[model samples]
Target: MSTPAPPFSGFPAGALSFYAELEEHNSRDWWLAHKDAYERDVHEPMLALLDGLEDEFGEARMFRPNRDVRFSADKSPYKTHQGALVGSGTVLGYYVQVSADGLRAGGGFRAASSAQTARFRAAVDAPASGLALEQVLQSLRRGRFEVLGERVKTAPRGYAADHPRIETLRHKELMVVRDFGAPDWLSTRRALTKVRDTWRSVRPLVEWLSQHVDSDAATT
Candidate 1:
């Protein structure tokens, strides 16, 4: 039999401090100087956390520490934070990000493709699914999750300006986020508990998106 993964003891104290300093000195020279700290404090703990989560949440993928500055004016060489996507893909998954500010957990579709956007609107325009989505959002809000998205200033072109669900109709990309915000629990095993619970609370949003927005429309 295989050995069970060790319990996540939590991120080292240096993890936050390293990112704190990285934000101030986000350059290759500084990163090369502190490569060991990055590994010992930041990278390793992330791997452990992901390992602990994998059995129940599926596989996880970590974002590179290197910044993709190809199209950006800000030429910083390293990220001020670390983030990962949990689960298989954008269809239905979770996201976690840690930075100097603290940890955040999220789920749901960040942006819908054109076909997905069409399906999403169609479902929202349908009373039953629209009410179902609203109930899910309400439940998340009560659990302290924030619902956000890129949205048009007014209703989309085809939707009426005064439509009952016009506000939701304006969203171009829909997602949910929960920020732990520098809590003391962040340095304890409870951090994993917190993240797990947050993901649970947001799962309904992921399900809604999969059923109403993506599933069939995604293939075409």
Candidate 2:
């Protein structure tokens, strides 16, 4: 029988260095030459990390290293960073990425359709659910998690510029992120603890979306 993959022991320092070099030499030849290091330092570590996290976070997905350049102006052949999603399937959930910058973890709906956006806005407009969401955002902010999302300068079509929950309503795609760039603990088992804590903190936000937004759309 095949041996089970070992538990995550944190990412190696080389993972950061590899990405730092990739940022400068984002070419096919550079990538091909250093592919072994990518596997040893970056890819494998991520897989192990995800495996360690699966128990608490459920199945996770490792994104491809290749960037989709078909419709983009900046056609970089390869992505500068590696990323993954946890507890996600057809719906949005948690995300983590590592690069020269180090680690980033957060959660939200990324590609909410117009219908979904309408539903999200509706939930935010209601006093009970909207207030609950605001509380969650405030708590995350208190914990220093950065709230990020695409938004309009003014209010969305139906919501007033003066609306109380306009900021939340204006979000086309909402996510919260914590960026820990090259911390000393990054290359140790502490990385696993840190990531788990962060994801747990993000759970309420994810649950809010699931309960107030995704659940209905899922069945339809």
Candidate 3:
């Protein structure tokens, strides 16, 4: 009979080492050789982490390790890192990733449609909602989370260049992230604590995006 996996204690150091080597040797042959280590050291630990978070954070889905190369020039067969998402049905959610660099955790929105973008920019242009988002970002920044997003060089089509929240309106994607490079805590249960705390810290932004951008999608 096969042995069952142990509960998540934390990701092993081997997880980090495995990814580090994968980065240097990103090829089909190398990955095939290391697949066993990947399963034992990386995949199972992440599952345990997600299981640990589900009670509070909702269930999370890990991204497939295989890369879709049909539309891309870089046709490497696999992803360099593994990532997962919680509360992701809408445009907003919490995200986490682990790799050679260590752990990264945060929350916010991505893959917004034109309609969602319209709602997002309209909310940013308004007084109450605009101020609320700004405040959430400020609060997260104060707590050491880095607010990040893709942006246009100029304001989107109807908003003025000098509009008060032009910068925010330019965002196509927005999120807050923290990188915890291979720390001593990574190989212990404490890694869960750090990820949980970071996700909680950024939850406001994700909530704000859901309220302003995602909430209306059901109707329109």
- The residue-by-residue lDDT of candidate 1 on 137-213, one tens digit each, is 88888888887878889889899998888888898768788988777778788888888888888877777877777
User: After superposing candidate 1, which stretches have Cα over 4 Å from the reference?
Assistant: 1-6, 88-92, 215-220
Residue-level lDDT for 159 in candidate 1? 90
User: In order, how many clashes per candidate?
Assistant: 0, 0, 0
Residue-level lDDT tens digits of model 3 in 88-195: 564468888999999999988774567877888888999999999999888888888887888888879998999988888898778889989998989999999999
Displacement of residue 161 (Cα, Å) in model 2 is 1.1
RMSD of 3: 3.3
Candidate 2 clashes between residue pairs 3 or more apart in a chain or in different chains: none
Name the regions of candidate 3 deviating beyond 4 angstroms. Answer: 1-5, 215-220
Cα lDDT, all candidates: 0.79, 0.85, 0.85
Better of 1 and 3 by TM-score: 3
Best by lDDT: 2
- For model 2, what is the alpha-carbon lDDT of residue 214? 70
Angstrom error at residue 144, model 2: 0.3
